[model samples]
Target: MVLRIFGLSFAVTVVSIIIAALYGGPQAVLLVVILSILEISLSFDNAVINATVLRRMSEFWQKIFLTVGIVIAVFGMRLVFPLVIVWLASGLGPVLALDLALNPPADDAAYFPDGSPSYETLLTDAHPQIAAFGGMFLLMLFLGFILEEREITWLSWLEKPLARAGKLDQLAVIVAGGLLLLTASYIAPEDTVSTVMVAGVLGMITYIAVNGLGELFNTPEEDENGEVVEGSSGGPTELAKATGKAGFFLFLYLEVLDASFSFDGVIGAFAITSDPIIIALGLGFVGAMFVRSITVFLVRKGTLSDYVYLEHGAHWAIGALAVILLVSIGYHVNENVTGLVGVALIGAAFISSILRNRKAAAAGGSSDNDVDEPKPVTIS
Candidate 1:
């Protein structure tokens, strides 16, 4: 079953490794392998959150996620997005950016020292804006999750209070907006403050617009009494049936979510290697495939339902990542630190979920063990 689901991903992994080997031999192969690992480490939490959303979607939309969505994630965000950033940052056309990437000059050979400020350098220079946009979008996502009233709680001490506080309407937006302004004032450079602030605002607005659009078009269903419910009932099968225009918006939301996760991964890749092609080939291919595979596994196996608190943990990890992204704008956080924090939090949550399930099972067994099943009455 696992092979059936992840066959394409395994194929892509082989192809990516072969391409890496062909391009730069053994050294390049090793680097691609390392980058792929790094991308996966940074994005495991992403898969969990994606599963949480994907399970709510219909099978058709889920297929879209694995098919059309992967294309956008691999090529659109991983490959072209950085080039677009460089083009915009350098005030040069896309062609010039592509040229510079293709034929990088020798060290100290061009006008600027060390090969005319490599693609990595250009991207690093634009970090403030990237941080602003990605950080804000992620922040909104984290806030929305934490501020929602949920029955289950992973970290009850923290989450319970937040859920209580969520009663204030739009509190998440207000808090997120205030934090953005605070970051702009204190953390952002004086010259780039306005740019960062604008980008952050835009990020928040984008989240709101996407979320609102999805809700606006959702087809309400009538219950037995003919009362209209906001969304379809039951699992993915029901969702798949009713999803139409709203499903498209949901697709848009997932793309944006994936982009927010990729933002950090893309920037972090430069720390390992500055070659844009290598980054795309390694992280874009392997990272995306593995994450998608994990998402499918969770949905097919009903992992979320079996381990209820897993979703809670994933959301908490997201909240942590969102804050880390925002803090990274001011401080130089090690990529390892960023990745490990998420892993640790999610791991702890998984353990908690296992313990809870065991406890529940034990309690249920204790109660029912003494109760005998009714003796079968045989008709002679």
Candidate 2:
């Protein structure tokens, strides 16, 4: 599995480089490779998060993530997202940005610098929005923790009255969406309101659609052929039917989650070099590769259940990413610090988890076996 994953990673890199070369020559390939690494580094937290949830997905859904998701992430999000941002922020249309990206209308070779987009200007122009976006996301995370800590049961009053109301965890999704929208309007400045709102609505829509579909399509199990009939207590063991609603929602959430993870790196990529094309080349492919790699690792390693805090770490990362995106609305976001903070927290958690498990093992007096701990990531 490791070898297969590596082979695929290598193939992806080679193919991306070849595409870059064919389209824009050697410089583009070099730019892409660098961007790819930067993206992967910026999004280490995302890999961990993907590992946690991808494990829950059906094999078919997992395959979609590996094949289809990467395409949207690299080309659509990394390469095009920036331009789209600029287009929305300023009156510069995407076509104009694309044109500028292809052939920068700069006179001096020093400024033109291999015909890359003037990412320096963009960096200065977009940092506050970046900072605001990230800041808001973090606030949401912290707020969520506080809210979760509260004795707010899942519609406790309503559920108690109506026993068959079913569990209502959708509040978290709705609250997340509402918070994002509120942040977009008030927390984020005038400029990035659109971007943050877009992201929030996108997330909320995914959460709602998936869950609603799951509920709508869920059956009484026994009617389906060879199915594990679920009667809330005693049921045979059969893979529950997927109405595709849950998968769709998971896909949507995963995409948003991926976006949240990639935001810091996307913004930070400009700091590495003031070349948008280079930024795209480096971060896009690398981010895509990491996503693919994590998916494979989770499937093969079977380590998701072993590391409980990893998912927690990922959610924290997502929260952090959301804050980072929000803060980008109005402040300067440092890539190194952002990456470091997440890495440190997750590392601490991993250490604590290991220590806790060790203590438990000692108390139980199990055989002298060392638990294989998964590595910690820098981001969620």
Candidate 3:
């Protein structure tokens, strides 16, 4: 299963290296390798979250995620997204933005003469709004999950209290709003404060709107003998069947989720090399392929249900990432530091999961085989 899942990823890696070598020789090849590794490390949590969501989606959507989703990730987010940022920041058209990307100025002064921000500079100027939007979106995701009551928790001592507090109406939104105000005031520049705040609010609104619509339009499940079983009315249910509207929204959700995850990596890639094509080749293609491979592996192995608290850990990591992104609006955080924090949090959760499994075995609750084995999936 591992080999089969990763076969395409490996091929992509080779292609990335060849592209780099042809584009910029041995040095660029090395850059591509490093950037790919960096993206994978920074995005491990993304893979886990993707798996969590993908497993619930219909098989058709899963295939769409693999095929169509990759196009959006590699081309839309990595390529066009940056160009769009440049266009917005510099008031340049798409062709002009593409030109600036292909032909960057000799120095920062040249940018002023042309009245156009270089691609990298435009991306840098747009960082605050990008960070605010992605951060708030990620915060909402984390808060929504953490605030929900769950049977299994990695950090029971704290999680139990948070779960109790979950009963508060609109608690996540309120906290997210408060954080947005505080974050905007503290980190955003005086001129860009309103932009930051507005972006943050839009991020929150996007999350609420997408989720609300998904829940409202979610279809009922069909049981054996082709009978329609009514689904729960109070909350959103996993999509059992992918209709046109439902599937589109799920696709949108995943794409937005991918964009949020890519924001940091895209920015961080500039720190390594300013050549947009190389960055796209390394992080966009190679790194994204591996992420998809990891997601598929996790889903096929039933890793989430087996480990139990792994999802909790991923959400916590996301919260930490959200905070870091918002703080980065004012501060220069090393990407290595951000990546390590996620690794540490997820690592601790994995350990906790192991300990829980041992305890369950000792209590004769379930054997390792019972826990780790993948269950049959119903894909309609």
Candidate 4:
């Protein structure tokens, strides 16, 4: 099962390394390997979150995620996203932006040796707005998830209070908006405050629009009396698997979620190397494929169902990342610190899940072992 799931990722890793060797010899090969590891480690939580969404999708859309979605993720995000940022941030036309990326100026300290900003400089210079947008979007995601009432709780001490707060309509938006304004006013640079505000508001709007549309189109499961039936354990229920427009919006949400997660990784790749080709090879070809494969593995193996707290862990990691991104606008946060924070949260969750499973087994709760079969979902 492992080989079947990850075979393509492994194969791509080999080919990408070979190409990197040819492009810049052993040094490029090493950089690609490091960048791939960096992306995977940084995005481990992303894979878990993705699995939660992917499991709701039909097989057709699942294939689309692997095939067409991969094309978008690899080329559109890894390569073109940087170019767009440079174009918009620098007011350079698309042609010049592409040219700058292809032929980055020589580095000297911060700026180019010729005193012009390098491609990396332009990209990093745009970090405040990027962080604002992606950070707000992810913050909304985390907030919305934790605020909702659920049958199962991972960190009951914290989640119980949040769930009570969820009883208030739009509490998630209220908190997220307050944070955005606070960060923009005090945390972001004065000159970039307006830009940060606009980006952050747009991020909040995008999440609401997509998620709202999805829920609007989704038809929840109904009992014989036509009453809606909620999930027993309360995460993504079978309603999430709706086809047509609901599915499309859910798919759109997944893509945006991925972009938000990848924002930091794409920008951080410059610290390793400025070669766009190498970055794409490592992040797009190698890192992204493995994330997709891991998502598939989790969905097919029912890993999320088996380890109930894993989803909670991933969302908490996302919350931490959101805070880090917002904090990074005003202060430099080490990439290692960002990565380790996520790892630590997820590791703790995993251990907690094991203990729960053992306790259930010791109590001879055989009923707890069975995963609920997804019910048929209606789409309006």
Clashing pairs in 1: none
lDDT per residue (tens digit) for residues 1-380 in model 4: 78988999999999999999999999999999999998998899999998787767666777777788888888888889988988887667899778778776555333234465767888999899989999999999999899987767899899999999999999999999999999988999998999999999999999889888877777566678977676622223233455677667778888898899887998888889988899999999999999988888878777777777888899999999999999999888888888899989988998888888888888888434344544322111
Candidate 1: segments with Cα more than 4 A from true spot: 107-116, 221-242, 365-380
Error of 1 at 24 (Å): 0.2
Residue 107 lDDT in candidate 3: 76
The CA root-mean-square deviation of candidate 3, after full C-alpha superposition on the true structure, stands at 3.0
* Residue range 103-201, candidate 3, lDDT tens digits: 886774564565555678779889999999999989998988888876566787899899899899999999999999998888777888998999899
Candidate 3, overall lDDT? 0.82
Better of 1 and 3 by lDDT: 3
Candidate 1 — number of clashing residue pairs? Answer: 0
Question: What TM-scores do the predictions have?
Answer: 0.90, 0.68, 0.92, 0.92
Best by lDDT: 4
Instruction: Candidate 3: list runs displaced more than 4 Å.
Output: 107-116, 220-244, 366-380
Question: lDDT per model, in order?
Answer: 0.78, 0.57, 0.82, 0.83
Candidate 1 residue-wise lDDT, 283-335, digit = tens: 89988888888887877777776676777777778878877877777778899
Model 3: clashing residue pairs? none
Q: Which of the predicted structures, 2 or 3, would earn the higher lDDT when compared with the native?
A: 3
